[model samples]
Target: MTETELLLSLIDDKLRKCEDGYMLTHTHFLSLGERSSAMAHLKNRYPNHVFWGGYPDAERSVLFLLPEYMEKDDFSLEDEDDPLCLVRVRASSAKLTHRDYLGALLGLGLERSVIGDILVGEHGAEIIVMKSISDYLIANFEKAGSASLKITVDSIKNLEPPKIKTEFIRESVASLRLDNMLSAVFGVSRSDAVEAISRGMVFLNDTEATKPDARIAEGDKLVLRGRGKAYFREQSGTTRKGRLSVLFEKYI
Candidate 1:
C-alpha cells in the first residue's frame, strides 16, 4: 500500500480503539505526509473526535489520537513525558556543526525517526530524541567524529530554537506555476526548476512535490530539500515588462 493509504488505515484502526474509551498512540513519529494524510482521514471518518498533536513547542510534532470526549484546556505538558528528550551534546572547546551532531546519533545506530530536531549553537548542539532511547544515549553517546563529546539529558522546554536567517525577494514571473515561481525566487532556469521537482528536490508545505505545473499562490511556503526555504507573501503590481511582481521571504 502507499504510505498515505497505510496511514489512513492506521488512523481508522485507532479510531476503533478510541470508541472503547482507550487512548491509543502510534510509536512512529509522523512525517508531514503521514500527519496530513491521517488528519484528513480523521476529519472525514470521525469529525467530532479529537486529534491532538504535541511536540512541546517543537517545530515538528507527534499526534495523540483522542476520542470525542477527551478534550482538554490549559494543561502544561512536561517534555519529560513528551515521548521526547533533549540531549545536550558538547565537544569541549570545539563548535560542532549540525552534521556532526546528527552523524554522532546515527552512527550509534539510531533511526532518523528516533531523532527529532537538532539545534546547533556556538559551543555545542541540543537534539530532541525519543524518550525510550534517551537513557541509552546519555549512557553511551560519547564522540562526534574524532571529537570527544559530552552528552547529558535535558528537557525540550529548555531548548531555544535557532533563529532562521531570511531575506526579502522581489521578482517577476510570467505565470504562477510552481516552476515559474521557484525559478524566479531561487535564480534558477525554468528547466532547472522542473528538473528539481521531478527529482523530488522540492517540497510544497513540507510534503514532497512532483508537480511542476501546480499553481502557486500567495501565503504558500516552498522548500528545496537541500537548498533553503521560501515563503510567498503576495504579488505587487504588474511590472513594466508585463510580468507579475512577487514578494517573498527567502530563508537562508
Candidate 2:
C-alpha cells in the first residue's frame, strides 16, 4: 500500500478502537503534511479528536481519537493520563545539535514515528516521546555524537522548550503576493520563491500553498521546507516608493 493509504488505515483503526472500546486511542507522531492529510480525511466526522504535541506551537503531533464520553478539554499535556513523556538529555562539556541527538536515538533502533519534537538547548536537549519507550531510552541512551549524555525521564508537563529566537525584518514589497513576500523575507530571488511554492516546499499557515500569487495577509505564518519559518507581523504603511512596508519575524 502507498504510504498515505497506510497512514489512513492506521487512523481508521484508531478511530474504530476508540469507538468500539469506548476509550482513548492515539496515533504515533505525525509530520505537518501527514497531519494535514489526516485532518482532511477526518473533516468534521469526529468531534472529540484533537492534534497535540507536548507543548503549544509544536510542529509534530499525535492525533487522538476520543470516545463519546470524553471531552476534548479533558486531555492536556499536563495531565498524567497522557501517553507522552519528556526525555531530558544533558551533555557533558559539549553542546549537541538536533541532528546529533536524533542520530543517537535512531541508532538505538527506535523508529522516528515514536519520537516527537526535539528541543535542542545550549547544553542539552528535551525530546517528546511515547511514554512506552521512555524507560527504555533512559536506560539505554548514553551518547549523542561525541558527547556523553545524562538521560532522565520526566512528565510531559515538565517539558520546557527552548525560548524561540527571531530576527526582525522590515522590508518593502511591491505586492502582498506570497512569492514577493517570500523573496523579501527569506532573501531569495523571486524566481526561487515561486519555484519553491510550485515544488510544494512552502506552507502558508501550516497548509501547503502552491499559488505564487496567493494573497498573503498580515499575521500569516510562512514555512519554507529547507529554510526556517517566518511570521508576517504586520504592514506598517506604504513606503516612499508606494510599496508596502512590512514587518516580519524570522525564527533564528
Candidate 3:
C-alpha cells in the first residue's frame, strides 16, 4: 500500500478503540473554489457527517467553523492535532473561481477566498481553513475516536461591524509609528490602509488625508468614506521621542 493509505488505515484502526460512550466524528474541509463537487463526493462516501460554516474577516482572508473549535477553553481557527496519518491533496487557490470540489471536502458552503488544508490523526482528522496551511502537525494532535459520539455543527455569528478610520499624527508621535494613522484606527494592515489613503479612500474631517504621515491635533475627525470613520484623542504618556501617545476611535 502507499504510505498515505497505510497511515490512514492505522489511524482508522486506532480511532475504533474510543471509550465506550462516544462516536467518532471527523471534520473535513475544502476551499471555496472546490466546494461543490467535493461535497457530492463526500456525500456518497461518508453520508453521515454533518457540517457548519462561516467567513473570516474580509481583510483577513479565511473561513472557520461556526462557534469555532474549543481548544483548552479557547476557540481555535484550526482543527485539533492528528498523529496517525498524513496526506496531501490538491486544492484550488483563494482567487480561483468557485467550484464544487471545495464544498465536498469541507461538507459545507464557503466563500470564494477560503483555503483548505487536511491533516489526519491517530484517532481523528482535522481540516484547516486559512490563508496559508500548516507545514507541520506533529505537536498539535489530540485524542482520536469518539465511541457512539453525537455530533452537532453550530452557526456563525457576526462579531463586530466592519469599519475604517483616518487621522493625522503629530510629527513627534509620527517618529515612533510603525504604521499610518488610518491603519491604527481601523486595525488593518498598514499596507492596505495606505493603499486606501493613496486612492483618496480616506478623509480627515471632510478633507482627504492622502499621506500616510500627515501631522495633526487631538480633536480631528477622520473619515474614510469606504472604510467608516474615527476621531483622534491624545492621552497622557510620552514616548522615546517625547511625544504623547495618540489614541483614536472609529465612530462605529
lDDT of each: 0.72, 0.88, 0.40
Sorted by lDDT (best first), the order is: 2, 1, 3
Clashing pairs in 2: none
Q: Name the weakest run of 10 consecutive residues (lDDT summed) in model 2.
A: 73-82
TM-score of each: 0.82, 0.90, 0.29
Lowest lDDT 10-residue stretch of candidate 3: 146-155
Question: Which scores greater on lDDT, model 2 or model 3?
Answer: 2
Candidate ranking under TM-score, highest first, comes to: 2, 1, 3
**Residue-by-residue lDDT tens digits, candidate 2, 1-252:** 998899999999999999999988999999877887788788877878889988888988999998898788876544567889898888984567888999999999999999999998778888999999988997889988888989888888887766788999999999999999999999999999999988878888877787999999889999988888999999988988899999999999
Top-TM-score structure, candidate number: 2
Q: What TM-score quantifies how close candidate 2 is to the native fold? A: 0.90
Regions of candidate 2 where Cα sits further than 4 Å from its true position:
77-80
Q: What is the Cα-based lDDT of residue 28 in candidate 1?
A: 52
